[model samples]
Target: MTGHDDWVPFEITPGNTGAEATARGLTAYLQGLDDLAGLLTRKKALVFRDFGVTPEELDVVMDELLPNRLAYVHGNSPRTKVGKNVYTSTEYPQEFTISMHNEMSYAYAWPSRLLFFCQQQPGTGGATPVVDGVRWLAALDPEVREAFKDGVRYTQNLHGGMGLGKSWQDTFETQDRAEVESFLATTGSTWEWKADGGLRVHQDRQATIKHPVTGDEVWFNQADQWHPAGLGDETAKALAQIMPAEDLPQNVTFADGTPIPAEYAVQIRDRGLDSAVDVDWRTGDLMLIDNVAVGHGRRPFTGARRILVAMCD
Candidate 1:
């Protein structure tokens, strides 16, 4: 089967039997799977609408429609409306732009798939954009790609805000310092002290990793995005000269102690943003995207905009 340009729309009538509606919904999902699988190798996104079902009902249908368990659930609310808060709520109202990067790149375990349900769309702006991370990485300079392949290290300080108001001391209240150090060491990360006296840990991770399914290397890391260790205002200003606005004050280094150029970092950011395709959302619309292949973000909107998100592995 080939992919279709138009999305399949269905309506559940009041007179239709429950079983009949379910059968039809399942059929649509199957058709979508067939079409998506034929066109893409690693991922496919399907938009569903007018299924005449509540979110709870859709959950049941999705359980059967997709083979894997729904893994990551998130939202754009002031507080988390669904699953865990990966980042602190303090970063709310921050307008995110679409960039090509894997979900949870820093985590030891990352989700292989992602799904987003748009409960409400903004009156203006706030489009959902996605990009192919693998494709974009391949287009980078050979030297740049090689440097990334050599592995890179980043420092993530999950002490205060990232820990969601839990200080480093609080998080390890029961655990021994040696044990915490061992855990960080096992991850190839180092630690330091923040100027304000909070614990600042340096975490080293891969800059490029092979997709579990596609076996192609994708550039992955959030080194340039947000800094783990909160830097002092004066120190931050000085580091701004050396690093891009996107790269935080924390140092980023190659496995062999080589520093990644600020220019290259900007290139990666630009390419990621360039590859993304935005979906103009409508109220009550559900948009599903492949997290492994695509990175998603939002535009700032005035007034209220309700959106719900669910991530499936």
Candidate 2:
């Protein structure tokens, strides 16, 4: 593994590994790896470039990288399941930028690694920028960092079958109320079922967390993504026009129930994006990210794009 001047992802190619630039060769290379997790932790992210890996052969590569893939349960993103555990990356509008956030950072548990395979590249400006979690934390002002020391409280209003945001069935991937309740019990969250068939849930999570393996403190919460203040004024007003803040799809505040200032959310969102480094997409390119050490986002594009992602704990 070689470094590229402190870039977010360390790239690997046929030239460096002495492996043939083909799907079969990429599988062979992964099969030969001794400590995949350790390598990913150190590098944070790895991109396989110039390798002609195909959609059909993606499972073979997944087998070596993600031995036990996970379903996208308890996730907030809008995506469609494509393969067994593979799903289309967040299906936000192609013209809008999806800010950086560690996948499922708001949940009780999250995938340790994320694997992305680019099936089709956009015509222009569609790079998936990645941010180093440690660097993002350091990029913030001391006061902002200090304010988040007590952690954050996240709230969600998932309707039953209609109305704002995602329905509980879609969010939990199940229609059984018992199943949803059982899962929430394990997450240490407080929840209530509204008379209108909506599910309101709350979770308090640490704003910063230590990497389990390396013990490195990194920004790991999704306060900005969930808070209305973090969203631009126009969008915030649009959402407000639809419903009140508490009734919105999702919301966030400090652990003690105090409101998180709009300025803080804006600072976090801006600093995170500014510190990110893009991993430009190319047809057949693959990227593997250490979820705890990095956060991922999308860049606005003008054309069609198809990127499939799968994750494992």
Candidate with maximal TM-score: 2
lDDT digits (tens) for residues 1-313 of candidate 2: 1232265688989999999899889888988989888899889999999898889989988899898899999999889999898999999889888888999999999999999999999999999999988888888899999999999999999998988779999999999999999999999999999999999999999999999997878899989999897778899989888888878899999999998998999999998989899999999999999999899999999787999999999
Cα TM-score of candidate 1: 0.65
Which stretches of candidate 2 lie above 4 Å from their native place? 1-5
Indicate the residue-level lDDT of 13 in model 1: 31
Off by over 4 Å in 1: 1-43, 49-58, 65-98, 160-199, 226-251
What TM-score would every model get versus the actual structure?
A: 0.65, 0.97
Pairs of colliding residues, candidate 1? 155-203
Model 1 C-alpha lDDT per residue in residues 1-313, reported as the tens digit of each score: 1221222212223244233334356445545454543333433455555444444454555454344644332111133435332212212463544344566676555555555555556777776666556656665788878777766665444343353233554444323556666655655556765665456565557777766556655667654443322223464467676556323434556657666676676677666666556666666555555555555555556545666655445
Clashes of 1: 1
